[model samples]
Every structure is written in structure tokens, then in C-alpha cells.
Target chain A: MEYIKEPMEIEERSFKIITEELGDKVFEEREGKIIKRIIHTTADFEFADITVIHSDAVEAALEALNGGCRIYTDTKMALSGINKKKLTQLNCQVYCLVDDEEVAKEAKDRGITRSIVAMEKALTDKETKIFVIANAPTALFTLCQQMKVGEVKPYLVVGVPVGFVGASESKEVLLKQNVPYITVKGRKGGSTVGAAIINALMYMIE
Target chain B: MEYIKEPMEIEERSFKIITEELGDKVFEEREGKIIKRIIHTTADFEFADITVIHSDAVEAALEALNGGCRIYTDTKMALSGINKKKLTQLNCQVYCLVDDEEVAKEAKDRGITRSIVAMEKALTDKETKIFVIANAPTALFTLCQQMKVGEVKPYLVVGVPVGFVGASESKEVLLKQNVPYITVKGRKGGSTVGAAIINALMYMIE
Candidate 1:
């Protein structure tokens, strides 16, 4: 398989292998696109079981993409993982406000994380369609808290923060929120997972 | 645990938890730092078992880093994951040439990956001390092939490409090469792992 394939065939071949290995895994087809992608990105089968996608997430995300909405991420690493060319084609923009001067000042003044402030800042942009949380669980938790107050109506939330701290627990909160969200159940996610989810959704829309 | 801890304490607490959970895992303290960082980034224990580190790789990498060397990566995502502030304090520079116009043109003409061309281009950088490969097996294979002919001698190579194709097979070749290297033994690696390894090494030295 390695010798005969061209360089471009690698990604295609990886998806094929993921599908074969994920045989008997029962995610709905709509959800499978994302599950397969997260699995493809990490080469970990754990996603197949742990991933949870809201019934409306896929359709909502695609619709939001078609509308050329704003996307926000917790980290620049996650921001970079998103394909820029494809995003531009869709007229979508990605922002990471954790490094913003105002956010830093406000977060520090309030004795809160920049992640928490960043999530709050995202709500100020009414064009935001998606929130991709990767490195900071506080970002995910803040979004959930805001959602509980009916403050922001995100088209989709990709909450895949990675760490031993509040990562998994934050994801559990995201799962229970009444919003379109995609998350993994346990302590198994990161910038890679968060970006893969966004890229996967983009591929689906494309 | 989450409620009482301050934002600054999150990272420290996460590392402590990783150490506790990783109890009984046998790795020399030096090697353990890299392994644990990979695990921390992905929240997966697979790396602890699959990581391979050359005996002198860490020392050589640190020495190179202290001299303010150049680092190259296969993908920009991996490049972004590297901590810029830490890297700057050491006077280390990171480059990802996959998007270089000359590389793109040559790769298209030769029907090879930009990754292959990118690795070859790194040799032109006389100060290049380390190569971090996360997205492309071709980059790893190219480096190993270059090493065989004594064309370029890298201080350290972090090979953690992902996928189902030649990703693992390329690492197998890298393992056989007489180079100072660190790699995961299978398909379970990505940009997150590569960057985490570099960041962990930076933290270790810091």
C-alpha cells in the first residue's frame, strides 16, 4: 500500500483504513464523518466510542459555513490547524482572542483565565458560528455557562480541551448544554482534535 | 480540584496528576519528560509505551538549543504549536517551508511531496539544529535517506507523523538510522505530539 500509492493518496488511503478499522462501529453517518476524522487525525479508536455529536450539529455547522460565519478558537495552535485556503473560500474567519490585549487585561483584572474572558469576548461578535475549544477547559466551561443564560447561540461547539485538570469535566458540561456541540466523553482531546473536527466539518461542507 | 486551583496552578497541577497516573511507568527521568508531554497534549497513554528516544538525543538537542539553533517543521500547524516566547528566550527560530513558492514549484515538477522538498531545503540552512516532523512520513523518510549518505547531520529529529500509510514504516526506517532522534513507534502521533515534545524539552531545560 505504501509503495504503490502517490503522495496525495496518503490522506485518502488513511480515511479508507480508518473506515475499515472502524467496521462495526455504530455512529450515525452524519456523526461518522467527524468521528472518522478525529480518529484519522489521532490514530486512536477511542474517539469512536467517546465522541458525542448533537443531532443538529452537522447540519447547523454546514449551514453556518455556507453563511460565512465567524469561528473562534482557544489557542493559536488550533487556529493554525484550520485550513486557511478552504476557510477563505467559504468566506469564514478564525480568531483566537486569548492573546488580545484587552482580554488579557480584563482576565487579569477579574482574576479569571484569558480563556474564560476569550469565550466571553466571542459572544460580543454576533457573527460567531462556531467555537473551537482545545487547550483551555475554562473556555469550554465559560461557553457552557453563557449558554445556560441564553447569552450566545452557537451553531456548533467543538469542545475538545486536553489535560488532566478540568478538561473532561468541562466536556461533560458541554454535552449537557442545550446547544449544537461535538465533544469526546473522556480526557482525550487537544488542539489536534479540535482542529480536526473543524477541518472535518469543512470537508463535509465542501 | 478545579474550584480551588488558580489559573496559574492549572499546568503545574496537570503535570502532578500525569505523574501520579503514570506511576510504575518505567522511563528514565529525561525520556519521561518527552513521553509525559506527548501524553499531556493528547491525554493518551499510548505514547508512554510507544515512544523511542535515543540515549544522547535529549542532551544533543539541549546543547543545540542553547547555541540558538534553527528548527524546521513539515507543517505550519506543528510550527505554531511551538512556544514562541520560550523559543525566543533561547534565540531559537522555527521554519516551515512547505509553503515556499520554490518548494511548491519543484515538488509539482518532480511529482514529490512538498514535505520531501522541504526537508531537503532544511539542509541549506547551515544552522538548522532540529527537525520536527508531524504531518508527513515522506519528510521523515527523506531525512533518514539524507542521513544515510552523510549529506546532512541533524542534531535531533522529532518524527511523529500520523496516518495509516507509510507513517509507521517511515519511523521504522528512522529507527534504524544512526541519528539522534525521538519518535513514536506507530501511527499514534501528530502535530500536537511533535510540538509537545519540543515544548517539554524546553520546559525541562528552563
Candidate 2:
């Protein structure tokens, strides 16, 4: 139980603990990576059954990361949870646009959630590939709508908005879409889960 | 839906939304204040039933705040979510000891969670009155163990650790203890929820 001096060691220990606790329950291949990371981040075994990764999501995410695409999150908590050092080494920038004044103003004007506006703004940047919508269903819904209208094309979407309101419905929409996505099936997600997925991808790519 | 220019206006609007969405479900009196804030913070009304506040917790927390007690959180996200501007006006200092090197080393040596070590360290400071544990059940369990040993006496313990593993059980143990506490009954708590309770207390004190 002594504190490990290296951050990598701590992370490895966490993964080992997760494997010991929930190894039999985890999915195979790249999807297992996302699920293990989620469990490692929250110590919640329920995520094993709840998490859904599109068949092609892991490869798509890795491709995007290797190509130096930007990662966008909806909450600062998610931003903080990501390993900036590893991402810096890979030349990937993580952005959380929820606090942007322009997004706030646009959301207010459009009578929509600020998360949705942030997604719209993120789409404006052509390099924004990975969308980590962890706190807002509106963001996921907006992303779905924009994709439907062919307004933007993202490499991968991690939609895990946790709540009773639009959470389930928004995720259901993602399930129906052809877009590459990784989501928890129900209302059981948060910024931490969102960041874990991205971090897992970063580790895989590295 | 227009952007509220003033911060107070935005807060007011947020409260209004909470009232409209879940006012009928909220508890009476001071308890309702905490519930509404939790809902406002997470956009989840389920917390109304899940959150349990000791009858003496609000008064105890207010007394400590008025006395300029140091607020200790287990995570930086909880620290960031607290209303620091208001706490600063009240001369209350906030501390998150999870990242402290001493606590980290202790956690590693003891083979316990960093949060447990952080709580142990916080107890060393007699001024640590309020324990805002939003992300770690081991911390709450450790606090309860210390209290049983008559080692540390805290004014209030906000135990809102999220996860399936040991989260509900740890909170159940807290419910049986004599310590004045505010906790979510199950695996549905987080840093935001913990911060919401503290923010509610701050607003009520203000």
C-alpha cells in the first residue's frame, strides 16, 4: 500500500486491481480497454455491463489521435482528469469549451444548453476530432443533429452524459446514428468517465 | 433563455429552474436548501431522496464556517466546485490534502487510499472542522474509525463517495455513527454533489 513514486506505476496498479476485481466481466480487445479504464477511474464494476463501444470506435479513436486531432470535453473536471503530459507528448490538445463566453452567449441566444453551443463552436475547428460529451445530453444531441445535417464530421464521439432528463434519449440517438461512438447505455456517466475513455485511448496510442 | 449578465441573476435563474423542475419533490426547511442546490448542481432530482442530512449538520456547518474553519475536500474537483469567492469573504480556507506528498507517501506505505491518508492528515490540524469527502469511501471509513477511537472530532462530515464498490456500505456505516453528517445513501454521489452541499451551506450563511 505504499505510495508508488511514479505516476505510471500508480496507473498500472489501478489497472491490475481492476483486472483482479472484474476481469471475467470485461469485454475483449479495444472495448475492454475503455471499460477497464472506466472501472479504474471510478472503481465501479457496474460499468462492465453498461458501457457500449461501437465496433470501430477504438481504431477510429486511435487513428484520430495518431493524426494529431484535438480532444474536446464539456466539463473542466474531464479536462483536469486527462493526462496532459502524455497528450502533450503525442501532440494532442484537450479543450473544454463550456466556460467560453461566446458559447454562453450563443447558448443564451439560441435558447439551448451551453454544452450544445460549445459543441457547435468545437465543430467550427476542423481539427476537432474526438468529442467527449460527459455532462450534457444537449451536447450529444447537438452533435447528432449536426452530423445528421452533414454540418460536421468527427472521428469519434464519447457520449456519457449522466442524468434522468435527456441522458438516455441522447445516447439512444447516438446508438441509431452511423457515427463512431462510445457510450454508457443508461444514465450513468460523468466527466470522470469521459476523461477515462480519452486517457485509455492516449495510453493505447502511446 | 437569455444570458444573465449578473452572477447573482444566473444563480437566481438556476434556482428558479430547480424549483420549476423539482420543487414539489424537495424536503422542507433547511434540508430543502441542500436538496435544491444538489439538484441545481447535478441536474438530477434523484438526490432529493438519496441525500441524508443530520438535523444538526446545517447549524454545525454554519457555526464552523462562521468561526473561519478550514474546509477540507478529498478531490480537486470538489475544491473547484466550492464557492470560493463567498468562502473567502467569510474568511474560511479550503484545503484538499489528497495531493499532499506526505499523504501520498502515507497512503502508499499504509496500503490504503490516498483519501484515507488525507483525512488522517487533516485531523492532525485541529482547525479542520468540515470534512467534504465526495470521492472516497475509504476516507469516510477512516474518519469513522478515528471517531470511534476518539482521535478526531469533526464538526461536519459530508460523505458523498460515488461507486458500487464499498460506496453504499461505507455510507451505511456513516449513517449508524453518531457523527453529524451529510451523505448520499447509495452509489450516486460525486464531487459536484459534495460541493453543492457546501455551496448551499455557504449561501444559507451569507
- Best by the lDDT measure: 1
**Weakest ten-residue segment in model 2 chain A by summed lDDT:** A1-10
List-wise, what DockQ does each model earn?
A: 0.62, 0.17
Docking class of 2: incorrect
Candidate 2 TM-score, C-alpha based: 0.74
Q: What is the lDDT of residue A21 in candidate 1?
A: 90
Clash count list over all predictions:
0, 5
CA lDDT for candidate 2: 0.80
Per-residue alpha-carbon lDDT of model 1 for A100-152, expressed as tens digits?
Answer: 99998998898878888888888788888899998888888878878888988
Top candidate (DockQ): 1
Clashing pairs in 2: A1-B108, A1-B111, A2-B108, A2-B109, A3-B108
| CAPRI-style class, candidate 1 | medium
Task: Please identify model 2 stretches exceeding 4 Å from their true place.
Answer: A1-26, A36-50, A66-69, A84-91, A101-113, A149-151, A203-206, B1-26, B32-50, B65-69, B83-93, B101-112, B145-151, B164-169, B185-188, B203-206
- Per-residue C-alpha lDDT of model 1 across residues B1-206, encoded as one tens digit per residue: 14422587787788788889888886888888888888888888878889999998999999988888899999988999998889999999999999899998998898888888888888777678899999888888888887898888889999999988888999898899888999999888899899998998887776
Residue A7 Cα positional deviation in candidate 1, in Å, after optimal superposition: 3.3
